[model samples]
Target: MGRETNCTEAADTLQRLREVPIEALVPVIDRSDPGRLGAWQPVIDGDFVREYGSLSVKNGDYPKLSLIIGTTSDEGASFSKLGLNTTEQIFDYPVKQILTAKIL
Candidate 1:
C-alpha cells in the first residue's frame, strides 16, 4: 500500500520533470541550486528501482530491519556529469556506461 503511494508520487514527479527542457536544467544544476532537485530524483522505474525501499517492510521480506535516513545540505552536488552534456552524449549514456564510470 505504502509502496504504491511512493511509486505513484515518484512517477508523477518524473512525468512533470520530463516535460522540462534539459538546457534550462543545466544552469540550475551548475549553480548547485537546492530547489531544482526534482529532475535529479529517483523515478519509479521497475529496472533500476525494482521496488520502493519501504516495500520490504510491508511484504515482510526482511527478517531483521534497521533503517537509517541521512541528509546532505547540497544533495545536488553529487550530480556532476563526467562527460555527458550534449544530447548525443546523453543518448549514448547507458546503464553500463554509468556503472563503468562509477567503477573507474
Candidate 2:
C-alpha cells in the first residue's frame, strides 16, 4: 500500500486512504483461482529495498548478515496451472531462466 512519489502525490494518496472505508483497504485474494491477484510484496523506496532483493545479492551487494535461499519443488506449478493453458506451455515457460538471471 506504500508507494514512493513526490510529496504532493504522497499527500493525495494519504488523503484518499483516509476517506476510503477501512474495509476497502483489505486486499482480495482468491485461492481457488489465484491469477493476477493481490500479492505480498515490498515497496521499492530506494533506501531499504533499492531493487528486487534477489537482484541486489546477484549484483554482489551482500548484506552484513546471514542469508537463506531456497524454493520448494514445483513452487510455481500451482500458479502456472491456473495461469497457463497446457502442460507443454508450462514446460516451455522461462521459469528457470528468470530464476537464474535473478540469482546469477
Candidate 3:
C-alpha cells in the first residue's frame, strides 16, 4: 500500500539522519524546519542549555549578566485568528471559550 511505502521511506530517512553528526545535521534541520516544529528538536547539551529554561534560571546555571527581554505589542497577534480588525472582535474571540469547553 501507499502508506507502507511512505512509512518505509520515512524509516530510511530517519536512519540516515541518525547516522549523521549533530553538528552537520543542525543546519539541515534549521533549513528544513524553519518553524522548528518538526521531528528534530533542541537538546540541553549541558554547556549552553543545561536544562529546561526555567529550571536553569532558577538553579542559577544561566548567565548572571544583565539581560533584557521584551516583545512587541503585536507579538501575540501572530498566533491569533485572522480578520481580528476591531478591539471588540479581539476581546470577544472564542479562544477562551474554546479552551474552557475543552477543559470541561
Candidate 4:
C-alpha cells in the first residue's frame, strides 16, 4: 500500500482503539503482524509527552536529574529486517516511525 494510505489507516485504527477496553487490546495486539504492528511508541500528548525526546533534551525541557540509558541484549533483534542494507533505508526507518507516531 502507498505510504499515505497506510498512515491514514494507522491513524484511523488508533482512533478506534481509544474506545476499546484495555483488556480487548491484548487479542488485537496478538493477532497483528509482528513487524507491521502500528507504532508502539509513546503518544506526544501535550500534557505528558510535550515534544520529541531529542527536542526535549536539547531544550532542557525535562527535570534536571541523573539519566540512565540502557537496553536489553536482544532488543535490536526485534526490529531487524533482511532488506534494509542501504544507509538510506536504515535512516529512513526511524523517520517513518516518527511520522507514524505524529499521525496518531
Lowest summed lDDT window (length 10), candidate 1? 1-10
Per-residue lDDT of candidate 1, residues 3-65 (tens digit): 322333565766655655767655655555444556566676887766766895688755574
- Quote model 4's TM-score: 0.41
Residue 65 in model 2: lDDT: 71
Q: In model 3, what lDDT does residue 35 have?
A: 42
lDDT by residue for model 4 over 1-104, one digit each (tens)? 12222333565765665656667665555444557534566779998788999999899888887887787653453366645645687678777877878988
Off by over 4 Å in 2: 1-28, 31-33, 64-74, 83-104
Model 1 per-residue lDDT at 55: 94
Error of 3 at 25 (Å): 20
Q: Choose the strongest candidate by TM-score.
A: 4
Report the number of the highest-lDDT candidate: 4
Which model is ahead, 1 or 2, in terms of TM-score? 2
Candidate 3 achieves a global lDDT of: 0.58
lDDT of 4: 0.62
Q: What TM-score number comes out for model 3?
A: 0.31
lDDT by residue (4-57, candidate 3, tens digit) is 223345657656656666677545543453343424445787876568878877
* Candidate 2, 1-104: lDDT as tens digits: 43312224555777755665545444322223455442444778798788987888789886667776887765465456565655677775566656667888
Kindly give the stretch of ten consecutive residues in candidate 2 with the minimal lDDT sum: 1-10
* TM-scores vs. true structure, each candidate: 0.27, 0.32, 0.31, 0.41
